[model samples]
Target: MTVLLTGLPSAGKTSLATAARAALLAAGHRVEVLDGDVVRRELWPELGLSPEDRERNLTRIGSVALLLARNGIITIVAAIAPYAHSRAALRAAHAGVPFAEVHVATPVEVCRRRDVKGLYARQARGEITGLTGVDAVYEEPLTPDLRIDTTLEDVGESAARLVDFILHGPVLSSPHGGRECSGRF
Candidate 1:
């Protein structure tokens, strides 16, 4: 199974992925999280931050996720993946594999407020350019398998809902108020 968790820099994508990975591990499933930061640093350190570079990075990560899925491992990808075409292509390429997308739909304003890396600040200061959802385009997913809003729910609940979807199917608003489970959020 390959779970693609997409969101902006501070949208809690990595945090959600981490929590989901823990859930899978606790359930005795073999899972790995390929966070954008860790993948950039360890796998494709040479890749720049341009749109083209971001596409290339996502392509590489998608390949890795497919490989892990082929080996019967659940791979969780926490990446910005700001383009819809790239995500669509990746999902289309994985035939017969369990490929799911969970968009962490945190608003840009909320993301800016949660910017632990100070990326939004740097972009505002003109120290950076092509920031997704800012100067560059994000091309938000129109129909993701699930969508979680960090501004509405915390990381743990988001992950639990995601893991539930991965293990079963959509929960359709569990008693825990997972509107995300209904694929409406």
Candidate 2:
């Protein structure tokens, strides 16, 4: 299975992925996290933040995720994934595999305040441009498998919900706290 956690920078996607990974590991499931910033810095440093560049980057990440999933590893991806078309293409490519696109729906103001990587601050200082959800375009997902707002719940609660979805299947929830689970474990 492949789970893509898409959101703005510092929107808690990486932190959530880390917590969920730990929980899944503790439950004895083999899992791998492909964090976008780490992957870009370590592997694809040549790639820029342009739309085409972002699409190429995500395609590469999706390829690796698919490979891991085929080998029986659960892959969790934490990425900005600003383009809706790119995300849809990745999902379509998964075909028979279980693929879940999870929108980390934290507001931009909250993310700017968190600023875990100082991205927002740098943007503010004019040291950067094309920052996703700021100057750049982040085409939000219209209908994701799940939508999580970091402000609504703590990381532990969010991680538990994600782990449950991974171990079982889709756990649908509304922004206001209603939940409905479906599919087999």
- Per-residue CA lDDT of model 2 for 97-173, tens digit only, reads 78888888888999899888899999999999999999999998888887777887788888888888678764322
Error of 1 at 169 (Å): 1.1
Q: Candidate 1 local accuracy as lDDT? A: 0.82
- For candidate 2, the lDDT comes to 0.84
Q: Which lDDT tens digits does candidate 1 get at residues 96-134?
A: 777877788888998888887899999999999888899
Which residue segments of model 2 deviate by more than 4 Å?
171-185
Residue 142, candidate 2: alpha-carbon lDDT? 81
What TM-score goes with each of the models?
0.91, 0.91
Residue pairs of candidate 2 with colliding backbone atoms: none
